[model samples]
Target chain A: MTITVAIDCMGGDHGPAVTVPAALAFVRDTPDASVVLVGQEDVLRKYVGAADLPRVTLRHASQIIGMDESPSLALRNKKDSSMRVAIDLVRHGEADACVSAGNTGALMAISRFVLKMLPGIDRPAICASLPTQSGHTHVLDLGANVDCSPEHLLQFGIMGASLVGAIEHNDRPTVGILNIGEEEIKGNDVVKRAADLLRDSGLNFIGNVEGDGLYKGEAEVVVCDGFVGNVALKTSEGLAQMLAFFLRQEFGRNMLTRLIAVLALPVLKRFKNRLDHRRYNGACLLGLKGIVVKSHGSADAFSYGFAIARAADAVRTGVLARIAERVAQGQTQPEPA
Target chain B: MTITVAIDCMGGDHGPAVTVPAALAFVRDTPDASVVLVGQEDVLRKYVGAADLPRVTLRHASQIIGMDESPSLALRNKKDSSMRVAIDLVRHGEADACVSAGNTGALMAISRFVLKMLPGIDRPAICASLPTQSGHTHVLDLGANVDCSPEHLLQFGIMGASLVGAIEHNDRPTVGILNIGEEEIKGNDVVKRAADLLRDSGLNFIGNVEGDGLYKGEAEVVVCDGFVGNVALKTSEGLAQMLAFFLRQEFGRNMLTRLIAVLALPVLKRFKNRLDHRRYNGACLLGLKGIVVKSHGSADAFSYGFAIARAADAVRTGVLARIAERVAQGQTQPEPA
Candidate 1:
């Protein structure tokens, strides 16, 4: 089946400069995919030209939201903004999914208001992919609901497992709740309660997994409250950036070291290519009625392109449909006595 | 004045094999330091000869706490265990501080039971130093308390600031609360309330910092609840290890790449040293009545040596005294109207 994705052309730091090129590259790679670019008509036309661009359509919108805009303020005001317009396209069935690299708070708020929540889901979670020694692991609630209840965490587990199962073609995915320690009695009240609920939730629930478990491939899906997940994700990025900075400084310390650096350039390039974050840039805003993918605000063409691909992949794999089916089945399950 | 440190010789994964050599190296490096090695007599004597060891004295203890034992079981049952006995030496004023590489829960549980909390401090925090781009940033509550109230976080800032001020020779060290975002209205209720307290508590409070703030050197001491801090710390470690693994895998891929790896060996060594967590291995159990430094359970001889040096440094710098003074002074301040 042909897949269509709505692109927020005026979102993020570089806006159309980044989004336009990424959209072109994405559609070029997918034979049966098209993109609906949302932004100001005059401004977007400057980039796309008057000629018929292959598999691309431009939709006009009046307002633009700043990267640092207040989410509530942007919500009440900017109904015609590119971000809102893109999500609206999905709601209207003009596109199967929408991808935006904008203010995260603004994007989530607008998407929730426009698309609403799926059945049996109180709040949507931010689901992202991280690299592991064995392969890849999916983590949810990266920053959407900062103060998640135990119930919210359990719902996140279901949504995350569904997303992975749909996209990765794994029928039964292992779910692990993230905690401070691996023991049964290690976590705070929320995690402990969530663990109890998960144990009886009828899913393939493993016990508690610590922070290292995410990278060690202990489970396919790791669930945590948004506050903890955001900190973990950011810390990993910070540490990786620091290591790269130090490596550059060490290589440039002296003339001999610089010569060694020249000889080691190929190896360093290969190493960097293998760990390049752009390859894992896209993250789905799960539990929403329609598919919404949030790209890194500072993502370049490469990462933004991957985000476009991610939106199509989610649509093609029917991730949102699978989550809806599971939630429906969960509602029919007997309530705990 | 000479500082005598109590060393838990039977603690950690390697037990006496790691701690014994580390204690000797520590004494050799410090001019006015002595150690009381506490463990089983036979096991301790195997590592340390029957002859008199310079600046090292063996104190026989009959029990050893397993790494996976229940904290309460170890605390209530094993009073004369190596970890507990070492802390007792400090409690009785026979040693200035204690160092252990044992199970963290057991260490914190035992230490709190032996050395009560300082006045006005409801809980003790685990404070660890992390490698940052500028140099190093200190982060607290790494795994001590999983659940924390707003008041506890405010107290953590006070204690963390005091520790950094005393040890780093800065009278007023900057303190940053870790949160999901930098905005004033961006975090959970607990963090928002804690921010309010920090604003008027008279500390050098900068605004909230995201995870990247720890590595960017935004603050000298980063404060958070133990759960969030532990996740951040462990995620950093896991990411670093994964990057290292990828680098190794890339370098050994082919013969030409392996030759480039041989040339880049010196640069690689410096990179490892700069980002080495061992250099910043020791973490303080702050707000305690006396100093207690906790080393990594898997720490090698060099890291264990650093832990010993950390205990002595905390004693010499009067870290406990400073925290006590701040806590007492804080009690005199009137509650918010």
Candidate 2:
């Protein structure tokens, strides 16, 4: 029942301050789960004092890759950095998965380089769990590959559906191809071609889902190219922040509005709680041999804990194996030229 | 200088019920402007009784294109349809511009066919004015061509800048190439290539802006290919609607929440008004030799009136000439091979 996750303590905006406390909290909550904190020994000891929890382990990594470091530079030089070493744990069978909140480009590059891709997957896709109206919809290829062909999109769908089925226990999850319009012939050549593949892939392929469908809970797994996925993800974040800013400004405008705000503070709190991005902070890096979940770089201990929990859940549910099996099945059918 | 706009009264989800009343209201408000309502004579007269207004004119057409018809089918068969006849007004110089709330694909195809592309422009991008934190940001290629080259993106920046300059009175609008990350080396080859062209094109290139940048008002003009743009736009709409639904469900959960909702009514009203998508309707079909504006298909009288105003403003400020001139200037500079 033991599931171990390698934690990149030197990643993200807050680095060890956020990741270490989260690692402590996560292992405490999940009794059967343990975390390997990968960072410098001296710095790691500052947070994990007395080693009270037997589930906690500190693995020494010689270097640290910065939050803003270029992927090329980070991959080229920081070979022994926490981000790389943490992912190495999964590759070497020391840990079930690795969780990082570092530079996305660096993490993707290092993970792909060290762990390698699955047999049928050409490139690893960044899969993030996003909240939809009904429940959570797993969206993939967030930003791993900007220019994706139809095959890459098809692979993303396979991985996403597998992850959801294994973790959520949804045997037949609907996969939606994100397009401009819901019609079959609405998108560019790549999307149309991807649609044909998804339709015949034996999965529950729901036709095209438009941009709005991402939030409307039209599908369990929404597949798109990295460029579109990234834009949609970021745009949603930016909009949420803007809405919060506007609310604050409006409440502070005049004495009447301010007094009304006090009366409605409880409802406002409830509303804010419903839309908090942190609640859905954890996203998986799909199509890789090992399970890799990405936490938002700016995530606080609360959100980072969720990310750690997410990685552990994937390991417990055997998502990686499910994806590999599904992928192999998909690859058996010849790809259209 | 009197400006005339040809309105396709039989287009959109609401058809004549929305467009006719919207046109009448627009002419009543704008003294120097008139609208030509294009549709079957009987249907047009049903909405516009007695034709009492001197600023109004009814132009009859032989056919009406359905909303769900394919773009190719609509273009080939419905040549004398209301939508095509309305566009013909601009083509024959009978009206300064055309406004329609038709099928987006059909509208784009017909507009391009009838008006022709501006010199140096390869495609017509759908540009809409989005309300940001400060004022408004103009985004282009909403859903015209799903696949675009680097040169198309470069041209979008040029066209967007000229539109802002002519309409908003800002000579040099800051343009941001939409990408997943703000870094120079973040996006795919297409975006990277587009970034290079934008940086060297002598416009106010403000580097890359992420998805959230669209709402944060980071740039006055945000450029992306049609596929990404459409997804971003629809995702925003979907997110906003979902937020609204969640708010309603929360408020209706119990008596306390409903009481708080009553108290927070004013603030909620103000907040909704600020983020109302209706205030920012009527996206222009840019890069066309003549002007064509597309309103939301399900627009009400108030929003459709705004669409009419948008068209008149474009005609008044000479948006088409400015775009054509700037495009020619950009074309004169040797493109990077």
- Best candidate, DockQ: 2
Candidate 2 Cα misplacement greater than 4 A, ranges: A50-52, A331-337, B331-337
lDDT of 1 by residue, B277-312 (tens): 898889999988999999999999998998889899
- Model 1, residue A39: what's the lDDT? 98
Worst 10 residues of 1 chain B by lDDT: B328-337
Residue pairs in candidate 2 whose N, alpha carbon or C atoms collide under 3 angstroms: none
Error of 1 at A158 (Å): 1.1
TM-score of candidate 1 versus the correct structure, residues matched by position = 0.97
Q: Please, what is the TM-score per model?
A: 0.97, 0.97
Q: Candidate 2's residue-wise lDDT over B1-337, tens digit each? A: 9999999999999999999999998888889999999999898898889646788998899898888898899999999899999999999999999999989889989999888999889999999988777777999889998888999999999999999999989888899999988778788888899999898888888989899999889999999999999999999999988888888888777998888788778888898999888888999999999999999998998888888899999999999989988887763434335
**Deviation (Å) of A183 in candidate 2:** 1.3
Model 1: per-residue lDDT, tens digit, A185-211?
888999999988888887678989888
Please list the residue runs of candidate 1 whose C-alpha ends up more than 4 Å from where it truly belongs after superposition: A331-337, B331-337
lDDT of 2 at B161: 90
- Tens digit of lDDT per residue, candidate 2, span A1-337? 8999999999999989999999998888888999999999799899888565688889999999987788889999998999999999999999999999998889989988999998978998888878788877889889888888899888888888889999989877999999998777789999999999888887788989998999989999999988899999999998888888888888878998899888777777888888888888888998888989899999999999989989998999999899988887764343334
